[model samples]
Target: MFGDIMGMMGKLKETQKKVQETKERLNTVLIDEQSSDGLLKVTLTANREIKSIHIDDSLLQDKEQLEDYLVLTLNKAIEKATNVNETELAAVAKEGMPNIPGMDAFMK
Candidate 1:
């Protein structure tokens, strides 16, 4: 019983290390998303911080349309960043704890 407990503790430490490494890597990754017409684009880090935005000059002619496109593009960028973060985190969790049910949820 004591040996099993020690093994589990070691596994937990490894999982914690993996999660920290994943979070650090995510901070450096970026995702880009664009509007349907490609008139607007947004770039966000994996941690959901907006890095930059691009807008076509033609879209500036109409303020309302430009605003709408900006919103849409930003949302798309956030969604993409979230998806990438989740995928990477999930991979790390799976590698560290393959049989632990709801390990991902527990991490959060």
Candidate 2:
């Protein structure tokens, strides 16, 4: 029983290291989103860090429109990034997790 516990501890440590590495890798994964008319565009990492924003010249003329576009576009970009981040991290975690009884349901 002690041997089993020790092996599980070692596996958990390895999993922790892999999770950190996966998070770092996610920083390089980019997610792009644009307005329906393509007037506004955004880029963000899977880490949800804003990388860039591109606005059309027409959007500059109307502050309210610009704000609306920014809100909508950025929200979409963030949503996509969050999905990617969660999915990737979950996959890494699930893959590395030790097969503990009753933990499978929680992981899902």
lDDT of each: 0.85, 0.93
Clash number by candidate, in order = 0, 0
Instruction: List candidate 1 segments past 4 Å from native.
Output: 98-108
* Steric clash pairs (candidate 2): none
TM-score for each predicted model, relative to the true structure:
0.79, 0.93
Q: Judge candidate 1 at residue 20 and give its lDDT.
A: 94
Off by over 4 Å in 2: none
Question: Candidate 1 lDDT, tens digit per residue, 22-104?
Answer: 89988889898898888888888998988888899999999999988988788878888899899888777677664666666
Candidate 2: TM-score? 0.93
C-alpha lDDT of candidate 1 relative to the true structure: 0.85
Per-model C-alpha RMSD:
3.5, 1.2
